[model samples]
Target: MKDIFAKDSSGEMVSPHEPGYDALIADIFATIKTATEMNTGYRTPEEVHEYMERILGKELDATTTVLPPLYIDYGKPVTIGRGCFIQQCCTFFGRGGITIGNDVFIGPKVNLITINHDPNPENRSATYGRPILIEDKVWIGINSTILPGVRIGYGAIVGAGSVVTKDVPAMTVVAGNPARVVRKITTPGQQ
Candidate 1:
């Protein structure tokens, strides 16, 4: 009997109980939890940066600033571009991969969730995942939740406390649950 949900060559989500899946999750959790816990007592940003680099196995850009208390399921699949500012208490479920572009501003307590379980009750443990793309210069406000497979376009602004379940077009401002476009933001001299 073959496992239907097993990831093919194309890299997709497999059953959570599949061989090696639990081990991988456990490793990620151990590393991230230790780093985050250690980071809480560090008084300097440089210490946090070094700790995050060790946990992620990659050095973040010098200009990037991520406040402490950040949570991530797997740091390997997460990418942060240059000059991005991620405030404290942000959580990322990056097993499905999260790509954040340069100069992005993420307010505190935002959640970027990239994986979801099968809707069927009998196979609820089976999971599906999608990559989230946050384009350059986007501003995601405080307490927002960006759901799986969402692509937030360049220069868009997601209002505070919004639940973004779909793609947001460039330069648009969206708010509320199942976020709808409130208005288009005009760049300077765009009259």
Candidate 2:
């Protein structure tokens, strides 16, 4: 089996024709399905945390909280930082990678997608992935979709229902489809 981490000029590439691709996809789907089920079935915070940890393949910070019904593809590529709060029904497509920094708040139903298909119809099944970096103290509003390869900077706020297709500068507030900066925000404790 070829290493899924194999990189190329366009970042991570996974094709249906590639060796181990089918098996890898199957394993990822099964893991995510079981984790999702466990998340809903478990009532206690500890139980939910345990299931989430298994999905992530890492321990979440004690101060971090992820609500149930979270969705992820290839959870191994996702990393959440300390003191973060992830609301329910959020989906992460981390085939590339997803890194969420400390003290972040992600509202419900947000989708962070890091993978896209080739533009050519003949090669549509060929997938390319890019890493998403959400820096410290960011707030992502409900129903926002952060597209592939976006770097959301520190302390930025993504407004509700926005489709973010580009990089967001630090301390800025952005909204709308193909999101644009609406205003700059002043950090708390700043004069």
Best by TM-score: 2
**Candidate 1 per-residue C-alpha lDDT over 1-191 given as tens digits, one digit per residue, 9 for 90 to 100:** 33432351124546766776666667667777766674567547787778677666687898999897888767766789999999988998876778999999999999999888888888887777788999999999999999989999999999999999999999999999999999999978997
User: Candidate 2: where are CA atoms >4 Å away?
Assistant: 7-10, 188-191
Clashing residue pairs, candidate 2? Answer: none
Candidate 2, residue 10: Cα displacement in angstroms equals: 7.9
The ten-residue window of minimal lDDT in model 2 covers 1-10
Off by over 4 Å in 1: 1-11
Task: Provide the TM-score for each candidate, comma-separated.
Answer: 0.90, 0.92
Q: What does each candidate score in C-alpha RMSD? A: 2.7, 2.2
What shift in Å separates residue 25 of candidate 1 from its native position after superposition? 2.0
